[model samples]
Target chain A: MPILIKDRSMVTPREAIAEGDFSIGSNVYRREKKVVSQVIGLVTIKDNFVSVVPLKGKYLPRVGDLVIGKVTDVSLSTWIVDIASPYPGVMRTSTSLARRFDPIKDKTRKIFDVGEVIVAKVFSFDRTRDPMLTVRSDNRGGGNSPYLGKLVGGRVIDVSPSKIPRLIGRRGSMISTIKHYTNCKMIVGQNGRVWFKGNNFEDELLVLRAIQKIDREAHTTGLTDRIKNFLEEAKKNMPTPSKEKQSDKEKRSEKKS
Target chain B: MAKNKEETVLITKDGIRHDGRKREDLREISFDVGVLDRADGSCLIQWGRNKILAAVYGPRELHPKHMQMPGQAYIRCEYRMATFSVPDRKSPAPKRREKEISKLLGEALNPALFTYLYPRSVIDVFIEVLQADGGTRCAAITAASLALADAGIPMRDLVTGVAAGNLSDKIVLDLDDVEDKEGLGDLPIAYLPNLEKVVLLQSDGIFTPDQYKEALDMLVPACKKIYQLQRKAITDKYSQINEAVQKDIEAEEKDKPAKDKKKAEDSKAKDDKKAKKADDGKKSKASDKEEKKKKGLKKSSKKKDDKKQASKEKEAKKD
Candidate 1:
């Protein structure tokens, strides 16, 4: 008898499973009484529903996902941004800024030049057309506001989008830990772009190390704890807080004079 | 073909071929998965003297918006042979044979995929034949399916292919380049072993009706055998990854306890050192006045007691 595998379990294509016994998930099909998996992945069975978590795949854009995008084309009213996905995202001037401007009167080219990177949110996406992005805040609080526009003076790194969930962790625990330890402001895009801005080059490097570690071991279990421990050990060797404070005071005095 | 037969006997009276194999024997085949990092999925297949590499990308947005399928994703395949693949250097340009093979392979693979799950998307499969002995198209299809699976593309079942040929008036399986060039007829079949469906069937040259029926009988079993190998190849690759992940988790678990213990010890030591410094400070202040010297002595003795307790705990742990 062919083995009958359940949902959330790992399976390869053509593996015979009992139909209706497993929830029909992506890359799996039910033919009569048998369910066959389409992809090589971990089977996900939840509440009588079965799906496979593909080990490798391309990113599909969804609404409300924050993304780091590079401006590719500047038009009169719209700018095309490459969100590192197969589909390019389009940002209209009306949705990109808080203040209204006439496309004919205002030079849209001056606002967002090609080759610049910006943090934006996917406002709408349909299968029929390219995804639409917005820099304008949803009238929400900090971080989600319109002010979260063009990113300046930071390096962008790419990772597989599937690993983004692990980087974010449960309730943003993994990301917050990195932020606290490295003191780097990070913007993680669903499209697999990560922007890192730290107080010093050393801190930024630490953040990059943490990100690379996460990317390498995203499939493994207990990664969050490992990352936390790694950060803690790194924190121990960091420059003393007093020295940082002294530098801050000197900079402030220089500005005042 | 007749002229070549006089030069060499392809089959013996007892039914053994020149390669010293029975009529139904297949080439020695092996599969390697995830050979390319950038591709979504990739596989390398070695079938006898044939070497083929396949790479899969997308199920992402399809280009040429007009080509987008409203209900399902489009599966595109390109089959190419390197210039050095054949005995005579094959031209670098795409040939008619390559185009026809590419179309047939794509059609054969389409039945295996769940294209409806990804609307308006395209899954591209590129097959490159690095060495061609014979049956390059079959080998390419087999490798392409593995690459598709490696890429995590959904499929009903993997497509396994093999070619049956007529040589010395006998049906032979897995014809090599020499046999193919001299064979009277060739029938290549790609099958979905689990589905029991023939997705691709093509024949060149002539075959009697009975000979054709016998060939199908031989081809089915041959395809089934190849399917088993295909399944094994994918499973082996994933199992390797699983083992590596298991080892990583185990190492992390083992390292975590040691780290926690060291952290606890460091914190305790810091506390003890802080207490010692406080005692020293009291001693110096007490030296200023003779009356306060006795109180300072009591504090110093208490500090010693704390250190003794810490050492005792350490001894207990060691024991």
Candidate 2:
């Protein structure tokens, strides 16, 4: 079935899971069997309840998952940050950040602000409302000090947390295509948020559309070419001064007859 | 199939491809059905970006006897992403994605084809993606349907695959390699245009129920659009074959004049005797040919009639 698209909203495999509708692609299957934690997805109905039947290969982060995260806040004893899930996650102080035990003298403030993002790992979790998180997986600075920085000016996209694999396409075929084409650097958060940075705005915007295309049709084949074509169209649609250098006459001719 | 991180999918600095393609549009789509004469049905669909070939074997046998039911037929789908299809290459075996797709495709096609009539038999669909981009599974499903139709399987419906996804929570149709990886909410779908039923769906980022449904609604029309193309493709294939066959028959009969002389020599004697016995047949044909010739017509109705009659007679004889 073609997806049940809502008004311009990008729905995730996870939302379908939360709806009590088990998912295979975007299609929802009513809960039947005892789909366990490995059931990578679920249907969330009533917002409080969910039925998730994970895949066998799916794994829950035990003490550590070697994940990356961003800092959301810096409290007295602990810090709060988004960990790519509905679950609120926290990291304790005294791990780093304030090497001199002086929050005010912390030189790390130069790098991070209230909305700064970072790459860190899941230190531990209690599986409750708030799981303990840490950036000090390698025992560097555990708090939101060092790796915390701005994810500069590229378009950001969100995806179903569940479809990260597809967006990445197998071993990163999808992301690789975007990077190679747009000459951009992208970071895909486990939380389904993507950050892109390109040398310029044109390539960056193209990267955005290209990633949007992949996110839309991750299940499609020839995704690279399809995306390539889409961008070609988008580029053409956008009036530009460098017409000669931008045209895909050869590729168009190949597509023609 | 695994994606390659280094590869650029779309949009270079000057709007050129990483390899180069125009900013807008599609890769070339080349397809041929029944490429393999032996398979019940087959097709090779090459969408500029990827190459895939599909073959349909049978509604013929239902093996492992136990798997067969008494009143209904079974459709078996085996989806495999070829080892070399992706950048890093994949395992030859059917993995979770492939298995899930096969099942979904089987369901999507169930309503369209008349599978129930062929009880105790299994219709086997095998899909192979030689190269994959973003939507390999959707491609596989779309190709499988065409292959099945090419194989001459009786089905109630024809299925078309289409997809749309969300990036930064904005919905877009047909995600590309890069968008799929970097975008939010990848929703890959397969459906029948006529029936308006969704057979398969998968998504990435979060979507509100309303937004998801809207995406689906938008996709139905697109599915139909593609279905029309598929229909045209199928029709065009058959028509080309029909035209070729007709031309071949004409060519085969090109030597008729020489053959006729030999036949005339052999049956000339008998025909002369018969003509003498029935003089009216010759007289009427000559008059018909002459009337048209006098009217300044280069072609004669008599010859046209003769050709039709000759073909009909040949057909009868062959039968």
Candidate 3:
């Protein structure tokens, strides 16, 4: 018979848990009649399934994940990109470039030189091979994906990949708020790399602070509202561009009159 | 040298050792989990005077493709003692003893891990002994296991290590530097406390069959005790994180109500201003009645504020 343990907050390794528990996640295994926790974590039961939510872990790559990668090596047809994972991400010249080119005649290095940062999607990956990345979607009808291709003149900051969801928030709410407040365009990668591009250095710094705050406090609830309030406070303290523009308009009108 | 020889009486007649610990008494052990931010998992262990730091990286792509295993992940372990770790300054080079301990620790840890989950990958366990007071290998194994767990590596069970030695013809548990140097036999054992199995057992010096059996008997229970401390350390770190999450949730909930109250108060104040203007002809009479009502409202609001403050204090105390 399987014993049902309910409302237990934490579990240590080798602790006998219930069988038929559906939510069992990493560091948990099923035995003859019992499930065992393999690492120390909080046990959460949802919809009658038990899963252990780990407090810390390394990033494991998955297909269809958007990642920020730095070009490490440029070969004849492929570029070896470091996606901050154990396995290097490979981008073929055929899939990454918008225009077709012959690898025999054209130098792949000209298209993507070493040390260039590119935001791409994980097209395919398997345990046996390195992850293949694509700069744009294969669907021709989708046109150019705005976020795809090489990132230029922006600072890339890293946070724990697990906290990326919190930074993005539900339906991109947190990220949108940061963009609106700082007037900065931001790209968040699933591999914990974030690209920040703003009008000035100060705005980029503000966005960086917000991203770091979210990473540090990702486990907490109401993070979206907290980030919203933080951005609002930061905006209030900054000198307003609108005020300067208004003064300029008044001075022009006075001169015209 | 004469003083050292005179003090070589490691055990008293009642079976107490030089450190004043009775037979079967382990050292004071403590664990600090996730000590390094960059590593996947890391831990610092303080076992008596021995301080060991263990860091784990990977389940990552293994280099030198030839060494990659198709069916299971490779567990690589490196054990190093700092030059200043021992009383005498040791050389920085990897010596024979370090290599042997590293290989054995890797082998001992592999059985507990679910390596099949990450094929063609490697998990590296790096152990650095900052201070050595004997039983460094056992302490390193203990810290490495915690670091692995901290890294969120799946395992069948946690490994705990302890040493039992024959001092002055008596089997004593957790031999210190002095006892180790003076003892006749030292048995270091790494065990799966929950599984009731030994993964690594090494004996230095000589022991009779009965003496070896007695040492085994002492070592297992001591390992189990250390296992409890390891579990406590991991849980304590996570529980503290859980509390912070809960507090943030509570604060967010509190903020919503306070904002709503502020909006309600603003609208009510506007309504009072309109009422006072409309009743301008009977101003004196209306003002007295309004003052009394305002006092009553203030008293009630004060009471509500007190209740909210009390609840917050209770929550803080609980945390």
Best by TM-score: 1
Error of 1 at B65 (Å): 4.5
lDDT per residue as tens, model 2, A55-149: 11112334544334567776655667665443445666565232444556653445444566655556565433245665443535565333433
**Candidate 3 collision pairs:** A23-A50, A23-A51
lDDT of 1 by residue, A192-249 (tens): 8999899777789899999988987776767888888888877655654445677899
* TM-score against native, each model: 0.82, 0.43, 0.81
Q: What C-alpha lDDT, on a 0 to 100 scale, does residue B228 get in candidate 2?
A: 71
- Clash number by candidate, in order: 9, 111, 2
DockQ of each: 0.34, 0.01, 0.31
Highest DockQ against the true fold, candidate: 1
Indicate whether candidate 1 or candidate 2 has the larger TM-score. Answer: 1
Whole-model alpha-carbon lDDT for candidate 3: 0.84
TM-score of chain B of each: 0.81, 0.72, 0.82
The residue-by-residue lDDT of candidate 1 on B176-236, one tens digit each, is 9878878799999999998899999999977999999999999999999999999889889
